[model samples]
Target chain A: MTIDASMRDALLGAVPSLRAFAISLSGNVDRADDLVQETLVRALSHIDSFQPGTNLNAWLFTILRNLFHSEYRKRRREVEDADGVYAARLSTQPEQGARLDLEDFKTALARLPPDQREVLLLVGASGFSYEEAAEICQCAVGTIKSRVNRARTRLAQLLAVESVDDLGPDDQTRAALQATG
Target chain B: MAQKRAREVAEDVVPGHVPPAPPRLDRNAQARLGEQLRAMYDDLLQQPIPDRFIDLLKDLDDIEKGKSTGKGTTG
Candidate 1:
């Protein structure tokens, strides 16, 4: 069956977040948008299979993540990114030093294993609860938690963020300090 | 050695003011990292959706409607 009006609107509403997740997971805008296009195509064509009243965002994210794993490395041969688009985006954000720090964080993010990166994005960034992230990843909540933990640890190492001060440019730093201090 | 590092941390996080102690570094770091993750993702979210996606969805809507009227716009 073709996409109905509601489903069409739903799919369109989901495109931006889906693209954000895709971009974060893949670390390449071009590839991420390609994945988003393919995902929308797949979702619209397979509207029959989708169960309504569920979390549509999570569903789209699952599709995008699955597409990345199934075809990302094979299709691109793993050399397609490092194109400086991400770095270019960072340079426009803030002061010179923080921008460089953001550049390092982005590189560190890219270095994470895809699964860890996906879980991290799902739970840490995208506002998905551990349970929702688990459902999207088709794993247990515990597994999702672990990946988030490991992803954080490894990212800290990569960014050389030995302590709170080293986590450069975060406004949340004060709240975190207050909460736990 | 640890105290010195904590002092440096205080200077960064509280600059010119001293903290009672080096407020547990690990948790604060986690929060900061997560903050950065969202910040970066927010950048991606801020980007305009490419026209290709908009056009593709529009085309799908047109095709779906056309199919019902016996005037399919599948192209």
Candidate 2:
């Protein structure tokens, strides 16, 4: 669709965060990125519907989530919903230094139930609040809260972390900041 | 009695209580965790964006300006 300069800027600006959200949702870099591009297209076409003062990130995230769910529905019968399958296979061959640890975390994260992982990434890693996450997930606030809590618990358990507070400025943190910032 | 017992279970599982001092994630641990999270995200963020998407946007911008003619790619 025909887009304005401001709209273009906003879409471009939203790209990294959108891509990161897509990746976190899909767990495959290529798929995540394609989702981002699709989100951009959809957002651009429907830009007029976007309220100017409202949150652009939330809007973009909602679009990405809808796209993901639709894609999931389309592919559910054909493909396994195996989370982080790509990362797991990659790490098996061997990796060095922090790369190995990062892969370990990815695999653990991938193994998390999609609902839990989605809530964790949306709230914990992506910095969306409970309400915003609820909106994105189309669930009750209580549900979102429980999911986040549960996801954090699961991630901690998987990683052998004693607590969610144990999350630190590791490679994942840097990547998130780099993508979002 | 059941309600009270459920509440008690919930309290025990609250994130900070299980690990102790979760709010104050130790600096070193925070650093490492952040590193892992970032690494995973980096792969996604660094993936090459298609040229067509940008070109599509540019064309749209031109069309919006009434300078370009014909339909632009929608999908």
Kindly report the TM-score of the first chain in candidate 1.
Answer: 0.77
- Encode model 1's per-residue lDDT on A6-25: one tens digit a residue: 87888888888998898777
Candidate 1: which stretches are off by over 4 Å? Answer: A73-98, A165-181, B1-25, B71-75
TM-score for chain B of each model, two decimals: 0.58, 0.46
Clashing pairs in 1: none
Report lDDT (Cα) of residue A83, candidate 2: 58
Summarize candidate 2's per-residue lDDT along A9-102 as a digit string, tens digits: 7777777777777777776657876888788888877888888878888999999999998998889878865655655654553577857667
Model 2, stretches more than 4 Å misplaced? A82-94, A163-181, B1-35, B46-50, B67-75
CAPRI grade of model 1? incorrect
Top TM-score model: 1
**Candidate number achieving the greatest lDDT relative to the actual structure:** 1
Assess each prediction's global lDDT (C-alpha) against the native.
Answer: 0.72, 0.67
The alpha-carbon deviation from the true structure for residue A33 of candidate 2, after best TM-score superposition, in angstroms, is: 2.6
